[model samples]
Structures are given as structure tokens and as C-alpha cells.
Target chain A: MSETTIGGIAGRMPKFIRRADPAVVTAFACIVLLLFLGSLYSRSFLSPEYLLQQLKVASFLGVIATGMMLVILLGQIDLSVPWSVAVGAMMAAAAAAYGPVGAALAIPFGICCGIMIGIVNGIGVAYLRIPSMIVTLATNAVAQGLMVVYTGGFSPQDSATGAMRYLATGFAIPGVPNAVIIWAVIGAAMVFVLTRTGFGRSVYGIGNRERAAYLSGIDTRRVVMIAFAVSGGLSAFGGVLLAGYASKAAQSMGDAYLLPSIAAVVLGGTSILGGRGSYLGTVAGVILITLLQSILSVMQMPEAGRQIIYGVVIVAMLLLYGRAPASR
Target chain B: MKDWRYWLAEQRGTLLALAIFIVMFAIYTANHPAGFTANVVQTASNKGVLLAFVAMAQTLVVITAGIDLSVGMIFTLTNCLASWLVIGTGLETAFGVVAVLGTGLLCGAINGAIVIYGRLQPIVATIATGAVYFGIALLLRPFPGGSVNEDLADALTGRLFGVVPASLVALFAVVLIVWVPFSRSVLGRAAYAAGSSETAAYMSGVPIRRGKFAAYALAGLLAAIGGLFLTFFTYTGDAAYASGNAYTLFSIAAVVLGGVSLFGGKGSAIGAIFGALAFRTIGDLLFVFDFDPLWQPLFQGVILLIAVSLGAFALFRVRNRLEWFL
Candidate 1:
């Protein structure tokens, strides 16, 4: 059962449910089921406009999950995504308050802050040898503290740049959203990096067996560090897009995305243990989560019930294909 | 190894945790406006023991090389539950407390079964279960306005015999009744073996699953005990999501400070209690020193970074790069 999923070469998964990444097939099936269930509540659920809106919303989570997938691919995790997202948006908005050059720098400056945080996370995990969970946790706290200090007990006054707003909401295509384009671009990059590049192989290698990877002459620590850095940058970008979507930055804005992104990635069928997963599955998972969330809201489900369903879904998915083998 | 060496090694983490708590507490008291008064001690104990209990719960799961992110959620869930049920007559209050503890047990058992029997990794599994627990908590007290039996609350939270803190007494008794028994039992040893080397433990005929299941279940019970105390202290329940997450994070910090290995099989709950108390004082230190309370997060983060880094010094000593995998 376990051996089939490992040594996953791209295109190796046949389209059939029996041989395909079981989690991916399950996720798509769940997506269809959710759409059917949603249509039962409102015909708007299957309407093109509503579906596009869902994709736009799913884009934010999708970007964040992109980072999560990379880290999870290396069999590590970055718990700092929440605060990284916050810092990125806040800093971008903060930077935009300066002038034209500052406005131009705003996006990079925001992303840079996330990269800086990622580098710190990388150092802790790669060099310091601290567990990724704890180190990212500490960095998250630090980023949070920095934001609080910058804001000084109030919501950020700086607003998203006009460009930021346009990128998030404007129709870059006649009917498609700019945010969806951005997500597709990034998703394609991730697919390429994971499927064709040496870096991707190193990630799978390290996740599967760190010692073996190290002995094989791979710079394991550097790969681990870069994976975390990439995760950090994407999380920050997710925040940036979110700020643009809302047109302003606020305290705790990133909080809502944290659990959902994680839930989305795992739902997409990536193993929590790291070495096995597909980008297509993550895309499917993000849509599934977005639809599930939107439908639940449409049904007027309370926050408590939503949380329970989210938890149950993640647990169920993990049970479906992410279980640890007894040997470990 | 010599007899004393083994004994010393076993007690080292506990002793260090105790010593750190003592030093931090002494400084806190020395600098306080109230000095070393009974009231000061009482307030500190009341606040510290809440975390102390949660940390003990985390310690149980961590010892088995598993983590329960749901501990803080369980603490909050039971607190909300206790606020609703733990009121009115003495008999009714007893039943309420029992019901609250039982819910925690059930929540924990579900986590254990999911992770152990279903073979899911503990981290993601607990994260899911935690959401469920927190959701239940939110449903129970959507507006956070339930009350507890004041008499029971006061007796437990207030000073005992007008000198010592009642909470500290309860904490000690909990150690004796819960921790000591579990630590001495055969199951506990099996847990250690399983954590340190599951393959070896399995080969040696250890009851790995049973031991882990007990650890996870007991962790839930301990967290519920923490929840019960939280209700006693505030006399109400509020399902504040941020506070629940903070407690979960801080418990990990305490476990590290207590010398409990996140890697598992290396420390005691007694150490974790002291570690929790010490971590609480780290926050309280800002109040005494008159630092801007705003600096607390940054200050705490830096200290946590330092504390976890201490564990990394061992990495520097590894002669072979392969040893770094550990």
C-alpha cells in the first residue's frame, strides 16, 4: 500500500482512481460532492460567476498552501505562516505610505520581510537543528511582536497601494480575476520546480530519508533552508494579496488563513510526513476547502460548527491516505 | 555508569527546572511592591498553576514522542463546559466536575485512537481534534457568560489556612495522585521505550500502543484539570481562541525549559510544572521591572529562541554529520 506512492515520478499516476494518487482522486471526488451539496442550497453555487468568485477566494489560500506544500514536501512545516502573512501585508501597506519609489518597493519590501523571517526559520531548522515546528513558532511570535510594536496597539493605518488593489480584484482578463492569474502562474512554477528541477528531487529525498540524502552529497541543510524561505515568501505574498483584496491591513488578518491553508494542503493529499504529494491535488484541495467554507457560510453555519467540520475533514483525509506506516 | 550518576541524570532536568523557578520567583518577589507577602504568593500560584497543569498534560504526550495540540483546546473546552455545569448544589457540582473531566477523557481518547489505531501522525491529528474541541467550546459559550459555583471556586483558588496557596496544594496532590502513579507504572516505562526506540520497544514485547494511548488519554484528563482550575479562578468561561493557542504554544516552551525532550523519553512532569511556573514568571517579570508590557512578546520570543538553542549546542558536539539527523 505504501510502496506505490513512493518514488513518484511525474506522470506516473494513471488517470484511473485505483492507480492515481488516491488522496487526489478522493479530494476531487469530495469537491464534486461539495459542489452538488452546495447546488442543493443555491443554484448560484454552480453558476460561472459564483465559481469564479470561489476561485478568487481559493487563490489566497492556494498561494499560502503553495508555501506549506514545499515545507511539507521536505517533511517539515512552517508554523509562522500566520504572522508572516500579517507582516507582509502590514509592511507593504506601510511602505506604500512613502512615495512612488516606496510604492514600487512596497511589494518587494513586504516579500523581503517574509524572506527575512524565512531565513531566520531556515537558520533555526537547518543550522541550529531545532525542530521546524518550534523554530517557526518562535519566529511567528517574533514577527507578531514586531507588528504589534509597529502598530502600537492599533490597526495599521497604511492602506494597500492602488496597484495592489487592482492586482487582487481587477479583471486582468475579460471575466477572469487577476488573482487567479497570479495563482496559476505560481502554481505552474511550483509544478515545474517539483517535477523537473534538481531542487525538487532534493526535497523529496530529504523528506524520505535525511541521512541518506546527506550521504548522497546533497546540501540538505541549504535545501531545507531554501524550502522554508520559499514557504515564507509565498505566505507573505498570500498576505499581500489579501491586503489588496480587502484594500487595507489589519491586526490578526492572517489568523483566518493559517488553519485553512494547512487543512487545504493536507486535504490535497500531501503527506504530513513529507516525501509524497502532487500540486494538482493541492489545487483541488484548496478549491474543496474554499467551496466547503463558502457553502457552510451560505447555510448559515455557526463558527463553531465550521471549525468542527474543518477538523473532521482534515482528520478524515489524513486517515484516508496520510497514515504513518507501522515501521516508522 | 555509577549508581549516583544514573540517579543524578534522571533528576537533573527536574532539579534544573526547580532551580530556574526558584530564581525567577525570588527575583519577582524581591522586586514586587508587595514584597514577599502571602497575597503575592497566592496570586502567583493561582495564575501559574493553570499553565502548570497544562504543561504537565503536554509533558505526558511529549514523553511518548507524540504531541497533543488539543491540550489547550481541551483546557478551554472543559472550562466552558465547567462554567455551564459546575454550579448550584454540592451534589450537582460534583457531577458537573465529573462530567467535565469525562468529556476531556473522551476527547483525548478520540485523539489517541485516531493517532494510534488509525496511524495518523500525532501533530496533524491533534490539530484537527483541537479544532473540534475549540468548536465545541465556542458553541457552549458563544458569548462567554456562564458562572461556576462560587464556594467551590473560592476554596480552590483562594489561599489555604490563610498562608499557603490552595492552588499549590492542589497541584502537589495532583502530582501525587496522577503523575506519580502514572510515572511509576509499567505502562509509563513502556511509553519511554516506545518513544526512544519504537522498533526496539516493539521487539522487546512492550505494549507500545496501550502505553501511548494511556499517555494521550491522561494528557486530556490533566488538561481538563487545568480547565477546571481556570473556571475556579475566573468563575466563568470564555472561549477566547487566541488564549487557547497561546497556552498550547507556551506549554511547549515550558516542556523545553523543563528539559523535556520534544524528541521524547527524557523528562518528568514535576520538571514541567516548574518549567510552566518559570515561564509564567518570565511574563510576570515585565510587570515587576516596569518594562513596557508591550515588550513581553519580543522579550518572550528572544528567550524562547535562546532556550531552544540550548538544545542545539549538542549538535555542535557531533563529530559525524550523520549524527545531526537526530
Candidate 2:
């Protein structure tokens, strides 16, 4: 009884609530919780039609997050996803106005833009000795300026080009969306690269310890640059599909993807400090976020509420991830 | 040239910017008489004051090798709260101001706690909080509308004596209060040491966690003060406030320009204030010169690139000089 006094009780309490490993547990719990919530609120949510539609929406984000995951795995970030996507879409639409060949050119052109920015980012962080965060932040500003200049604040249209319209708006599996198929293909390709390539190991190695990796004779700068290039090209691809989805490219369409892509990568249990995540995890994370977003939007929560909840959920997930024991 | 390191060590960017400022001012005066009048001076001074405070807030956190993306959010939150709290409380208007500052402190402290205790990286933690803070502001005033009490706004925004704005007095007071604590105290010294090297500082027996928390809290307070004064300029709270966005980028630019290393440590509050003023002056000069609106963003981006390049060049020169000495 004497030992159970206030001071004694306080001294015995643990610093934080003990948590299970977030890698598998948190991901599993979120998926189940989301499914339960969605089913409880709207039975239609579980319907095949609704589920497929959700998959379709998640696919575009999933594809983008796949690239984002690769970049994050290298322990760096790209903030220009939204603008890059917007530019890709607008350029694609504008190219299609020329012909099918022109539309095809937009894809490479967009990828080239991504590669250029990636190279710049890599070089600045590597040789020029600038932080990736600062470099990317500046690039975002530059891209936004370019967008404003090229579009003059107007949304570009594919109204004159049937090819562009068909590319973006056309359906692929009767009721299933084309975006989902493209997303699956990209995700599969990323899995292959991550598992098989020497560059992939170099990326993880650099993220884990740059000095060690450099001393080990890996061209750390080159690997980082390639990571950025891959991220850039993938984001551009997403942008192309986004153009297809919207049927027209808008000035700020790319802005919305920035937070979600990052969130998806982290929530999938990838460490923010880098070198510890997978595309599969990112896919699951993308699905989680996309679903959460749809449910909230459908419930007609105020924009403010949705944003607040989004922030809270993301932070909560990260906290959980931090507390959970590492499985490996 | 071999001694360039010695020159750069003294922060050449600040000196160069000052020279540029003077040249621009001389040109402006040559073009228009009365451009240096009290009214014009006060207007420009007031704008610079707001940016200076925001930059100071940014500088404090960045010194800790962290960033508070939520600073802008805190500014908007304080503004929204001011509009709501000032209108109907029995508390004196002064207390209302205190409450707003307190709110900012609390917001920043929460961010600090999450960053430290939650073990989240500074960037991701703040990004989330930024969203939450902005969301809360929007929730409070779903639409872009709310008025500050007219009397309070007047006293804060109006002139104190002979065309010197009341805002300037408040601004100077902030500088005094913050500068002393930041430069003269043991805690201040510890902060610098900690920022320079976290591991070394920890080994030297500095309270690393406490120092970080204090830096973030101070940043929050400064952001709040900036927001409060901003209310006088706008006379109302708008949910779609652009103040936060302007402060976010401008604060970083100012810090970098003032010779604050982005990797943390080696910066001065006074220098940051000057950097903020320089940035404001550049924008104002363009307005005075009547540059095209369409050209402004492109021009600004180009200017920022040049500024960054110059900063890097100066750093490089300094490094080369150091090698020569060795």
C-alpha cells in the first residue's frame, strides 16, 4: 500500500503505449477497419461496381506512389509530382492535337522532363552540394511558373483530337477502367526492378549509409539520379493517364497528388529516413488512402474536416509505424 | 582571392544584398521625388516587419536542423482565432492579443512534442500539422470572412507618433525581446552548439530535446505576432489567407540569403531580419517600377536562382581560400 503512492505509480508507468509491429499489423488493421467502416456506412461500398470503381481510382494514385516508393526507398523525395503530372497531361493533349504520333511524342517528352529534373536534383545534391529538399522545392516553383506561362491560366483541351480523347477517356474491360490496368502493369514492372537490379541494391545501400556505399565503390550519385529519373518518368506516365481520365488537362490538376503520394509511401510502412520499403507495401498504402478519401468525400464531410482527418490519420499511422517493432 | 574564405566567413551575401538595396533605393529616388516620404517609408517598413518576423520564426527551427511547414498554418490559425475571440470576450483587447500568442505557442508546442516524442521527422510531421492547422482555420470560418474590432485594429495599425506606424513599435519590441534571449542567454548558446552538431552537443551535456522544443515554441510565438499585426493590415480574417504561403517560401529564402546554413546552425536573427527586408524591398521596387504581373513569377524565380547560385559561389570561394591557407 505504501509503495502504491502517487510517485510510485507514476514511476512505474511506461514512456509510451507498447505497440505491435506496424509493418504487417498496422497495414492489416487499417484495411480491415476501412472495409468495416465502408460496409457499415454504405452497403453499396462493397458492391462489385463500387469496389471496381474504387480500384480504378486507386490505380492512378497507386502507379504514382509506386514511383514515389522507389524514390523514398533511396531516402530522397520529389515534390514536383503534381506539376509534373499536370504538364504531362497538358502536353499530351496539346501533342494529340497534332496527331497520334504527336500524342505518342508527349509521353517521351514528359518522361524527358522528369529525367531532366531528376538529373538536376541528383547533381545538385551530389556535386553541387545542395539538399534534395531545397532543390526539388525550387523546381516545383519553376514548374509552376512554366505552367502558368504556357497555359496562361487556362485549362488545355483535347476537344479537337479524337485520339487524345479515346486515349484518356476510353474504357478497357467493359465495366472495369483502363487506369487500373495501366496501374497494375506499372506496379508489376517496379516489383521486377526492385527485386532484380543491381542499381536497386545500390539505392537501398546508399539510403542506409551513403558513406559506406560510396566507400564500397557504388556510384552513389548515379544511382540516386537514376532513382529520380525513374520517379520522374513514372509520375509523367501517371500524368498521361490523368489526362486520359479527365479528357482535358487543367492548370492545377497535378497539385492534389503531392501529399497523397508521400502519404501512401510512408503509411505503407516505408521509413521516411529511407532505404526500407517496397512497391507492394506502397500499393497497399495507396489503396488505403484512396479508399479513405472516397469514403470521406461520399459522406460529404466539410473540406476542412476531411483535411483535418487526413492529417490526423497520416500522423497516427506514422506514430504507429514508429512504435511497432521491426519485423525483420 | 586566396583570402576569399575570410571574406565569405563574414557572410558576403548580406553585404552584397545591402549594396544592391542601396543602389536600388538611389535609382528609385532619382526617378521620383517624395518616394522616400514618411508614408512610403512606413508602408514599406510595415510590410518588411511582417516578413522579418516570419523569417525569424523560420530561422529558429531551421537552426535546429528542422523545418516547420506549419508556420504558415499557425499564422492563419492565429488570425482566424483573433477574429473569433476578439469580437465577444470580456477580456481586454490586450488579453485577446495574449490569447492569440498563447494559441500560437500551444500549436507550436504540440508540433514540437510530436516531432520529439513521436519520433517523426520534422518535415513530415509539420506537413501534416500544416494541413490540420489550415483545416481548423477554414472550419472556424468556412467562408472568407470575419472582422477584427475596429478600435483595436486602429490602435495597432495606426501611427504612434509623427507618421511612424504603431506596427513599427510592436515590431521593434519583438526584436528586442527575442534578440536578447536568443543571443545573450546560456540557453541561446546551447541552441547554437546543439544545431552545429547534435551528437557533440549531446555529449557536451546540453539538453538537446529541451532546446529543440524551445526553438519551435519561440518560432510559434513569432509567427503569431506576425499574424496579429497582419490583422491590422487586412482588418479581417479570410479563410483563404495567402499570408502563410508567402511566409513559407519567403522565410526560407530570407534565411538562406542571410547566410543561415540550411543544414542548421551559424545564423543570426538580426541578419535574418535584414534578409527579409531586402526581399520585401525587391518586390516593392518592382511594383514601383511597374513590372508586368505576368512577368513577376518568372522574374522572381530567376532572381531566386541567382541568389542561390551566388550564395553557393561565395561558399565555394571561402572553401578554396581555407585550403590555400592549409
Candidate 3:
């Protein structure tokens, strides 16, 4: 009976299906499915303009997920994304209100704030030996509190600068969005770092076995710290882009991205436990999620239902690929 | 070294949590205008017990080296369920209560099934399950207008003999009925064994899967109990997303504060309960001192950071650098 069950399944499927990264397969399948479903729902849904818009929207999540993927690859997590994103957006908007020098510094300032938070997160995890979950969570709370105090229990007053708006909304190359271009640049850099750089190898090595990596002379602490810092900076950059898109940063703007970022990374097939995954998969995963969200919204699904679907997809993907033999 | 010293070392987290709660509560009451009156104590217990119960739920899963992010959503779902069902005649109310708790159990069982049989990571599984639970809760009370059994709510949220809070009594009974037996049972030992080292537990023939399932299921039940209390206090149910998320986050903070190792296999619900109480007191401390409510999150974050830092100090004692990863 068992033989028939196994053989039946194997006989009916292409051999490549069994070996392909489950994340990539699932992501591509979901994208195709969503597109078909979307086209059926509305004829305009499959248009080049609409699809490009979707890609543009996905670029925000993709940028954030790149950083999240790196941290997850190291088997560490950064819960501080919500506030880091907020801090980045808030500081950028606040600085932009100061004029040219402030505008020039706005992006760097927001990224720097994120890097600073990441360093704090790194110190706690790498030096103090605190769990990344708790440390990042606490830092997130601190960042939230600081922002709240800064905003004084009201919406931030500063608006996005012209540069910020242009970056988020403008078309630099004909018919292509700047956000997509930015995402592509970031994605290319991540691919290089992951596939070529020693730092990338160190991230995977540490994720697979931190102790083993350390014994093998990898500076595990430094890798963890840098990875966290990059994750922080990237999340912040995503927030800046979002603020630019919205024309202003608002309180709790980053709150919505936290789970979606994780979902994108995990869906892309990076193991939540770390040390296994690919940027290509994450890229696909981000696009898939963005498409899913767009389709769901177009169908007039409620926010609650969308959230449920998002969660279910993550769990489903985990069951598909998260159960592979333990690396340790 | 003596056996008691070893015992003390094992329970240092719980003891520290207990001490922190006492000190913080004392300071809170000392500065309050009510001056530690029964009313003040009762009010505190009523508020603290909600978090205490949720923290206890978190403790069960954390003890097994896993986490249940769905705990708060379960709490919210049950609260919503109870508001709709836990009303009318006494017998009817009893049945409604059972159904609500049963739903919680079922939700938890689903979480367990997915994590164990489906072979997903606990965090991701719970996150997914949590969203589902929250979605159901939103469906149940989209506009947040349902009444529970008012008499039951008042009785439970009110004082016992005009001194001890009835909620405190309920919390104590739950500890005795749910926590004590579970902590002492064979499955409980299996859970601990599994958490401390799953491979070792499997080799030793421990019922790791069953133990973990129990932990997850029981965590859901405990969270539901917390939900029932929330209904009792508010006399209604509201599917407030922020509140649900806060409970989930706070439960983790409480567990850590109670000295339960996030790494798993070491700590107790009792410790977590105390941690929850102390964490609640930190907010009260701000209120009494006339600090702006805006500062509460910052203060809570700072305190949590300092408290968790206390646990990290032990790592500095390790000689080998690789041990840091562990």
C-alpha cells in the first residue's frame, strides 16, 4: 500500500518536481494562479500597466524581505522591523522638512537610524547572548515609544520631500517604475552577497551551525551583528520608500510590513530556522505575496480574510519545505 | 554542594521573578492614594490575573521549547465566543462556558496537529493559526456588541469576602487544577525531556510528540480561560486587534521575566504568573507617579530590557566563545 502511494505519486509527476526548490515551485504556481484568477475577476487586471504597478508595489516588500532573508539565513530574526521602518520613515520625513541639506540627509539619516537600532539589536544578540526575538522586540517597543513621544500622540506633521516622492512614484526609465529599479539593484546586490561574498557564506555557515562556524574561525559575532544591521537598514529603506509613496509617514506605518516580510522570506523558501534559501525564491515569494494581496483586495475580501490567507500561505509553505532533515 | 543549593540554582529564575513582583507591587501600592487597601489590591489582582493566565498559557508551550503566538488570538476568540454564548440561565451559561473553552481546545489542537503531524515550525504555525483565530474572532464580533452573563461576570471580577479578588482565587484554582497536575504528570516530564533535548528524549523513548501536543492544547485552554476573564471584566467582547497583539507580546515578556528560558526546558507557570503580575505593576507604577501614559511603552520597554539583561549576565561567565551561540 505504501509502495503504491509513493510510486503512484512519483509516476504521475515530472521528476524535476521532486528536486526543484519547493519555494520557487510554490511561488511560481501561486503567481500564475493569482494572475489567472485576477484576469477572470477583471479584464484590466492582466494589463501591462496594472502588472507593472503590482511589481512596483511588490518592490517595497522585496527590499525589506531581502534584509529579512539575510537575518533568517543566519537563524536569527529581527522583530524590530516595524519600528525601524517607522523610525526610518519618520526621521526621513522630519529631516526633509528642513530643506536641501535635510533632503540630502533624509535618506541617509533614516538608514542610519535603522543601522543604529540594528547595532543595538546586534550587541544584545551577539554580545549579551540575548535571544534575537526578545532583544529586537524590546528594541521595537523602545523605538515605538520614542517615536510616539516625538510625535506626541499625533500623526507626524512632516510631509515627504519631492525627491522622496519622485523616487517612490516617478518613472525614471520609460514605462518602468523607480521603485522596481531600486528593488532590482538591491536584489542584485543581495544575490552577489549571498552567492559570491565571504560575508554571505558566513551568514549561511552561522545559520547552519553557529558553534561549528565559530570553531572554524568565522567571526560569528561580527557576522550576526552585520547581518542584523543590514536587516535593520534595509527595513528602514523600505519604510522611506513607503513614506515617499504615501507622501507622508504616519504612526504605525511599519506595523503592517512585519509579518508580510517574514512571510515573503519564508515563502521564498528560506528556512525560518536559517542557513537555507535563495534570493530568487524570495524575489518570487515577494511578488507572489503582493499579487495575492492585490487579487484578494480586488475580490473585495475584508482585511481579516486577507490576513488569514496570508497566514495560511506561510504555514502551508512551511509544511512543504520546513520539515527537511535538521541541518545540525 | 548541598541538594538545596542545586535546587535554588534551578529555581533562581522563579525566585527572582517573585522578588521583583513583590517589590514592584509594594512600591506601586505605597505610592497609591488607596494605600494598599483591599479595593486597591482587588483592582490590581483583577487586572493582573488576565495577563497572569495568558502568561501561564505561554509558559506551557515555552517549557516544551516552542511558542504559541495564537494564545492571544485564542484568548480573543474565546472572549468573543463567551460574550455571545456565556449568558442566560446558570446551566445554559455553564454549557456556553464549556463550549467556548472547547473551541479554544480545538483551536490549540489544530495548532498542535499542524506543528507535529504537519511538521511546521512552531512559530510559523502559530502565527498562521493566530491569524485564523483572529479572523474568526473578527467575524464573531465585527462591531463588538455582545453581553456575557452579567451576574457571573460581576461575581468573578468582584472581590471574595470583600478582601481577596475572586479573579485571584480563580487564578489560584487554575494553577492547582491545570498547572500542578500537568507539571507533575508523565507527559509533563516527557515535555521537559523533549525541550531540553529532543534527540535525547527520542532516544530514551519519551513520548515527545504527545507531550508537545498536550502542551499546545493545554496552552490554548489556558488562553481561553484568560479570555473568559476578559469577558468578565469588560462584560462584553470586542475584537480589538491591538489588544490581542499586545497580550501575545506581553505574555512572552512575562515568561522571560518569570525566568522561564526562551531556549526551553527550564521554568514554571508560577514564575510566569509572577512575571506577569510584576510587568502589570510596572504600568501601575507609572500611573501612580503621574507619568504620562505615553511614557508607559517606553518605560515598559526599558524595564523589560533591563530585566532580560539580568538573564544574559550568566553568559558572560562562559569561557568558550562557541558556548555563546548555545
Best by lDDT: 1
- For DockQ, the strongest prediction is 1
Quality of candidate 2 docking, DockQ: 0.31
Order by DockQ, highest first: 1, 3, 2
Clashes of 3: 0
Candidate number achieving the greatest TM-score relative to the actual structure: 1
**Local accuracy of candidate 2 as per-residue lDDT tens digits, A214-258:** 778888777877787777777777777777677677877776787
User: Which clashing pairs does model 1 show?
Assistant: none
TM-score winner between 2 and 3, please give it.
3
Which sections of candidate 1 miss by over 4 Å? A1-19
Error of 3 at A103 (Å): 2.6
Q: Which stretch of 10 consecutive residues in model 2 chain B shows the poorest summed lDDT?
A: B317-326
Q: Which of 1 and 3 is the better model by lDDT? A: 1
> Least accurate stretch of 10 residues (summed lDDT) in model 3 chain A?
A1-10
* Ranking, TM-score, top scorer first: 1, 3, 2
Local lDDT at B45 for model 3: 94
Q: Pairs clashing in candidate 2?
A: A82-A254, A168-A244, B5-B318
Per-residue accuracy of model 2 over B291-322 as CA lDDT, tens digit each:
66655555555555555555445446654422
What lDDT is reached at residue B130 by model 2?
A: 84
Docking quality level of the chain pair in candidate 3: medium
Q: Choose 1 or 3, whichever is better by TM-score.
A: 1
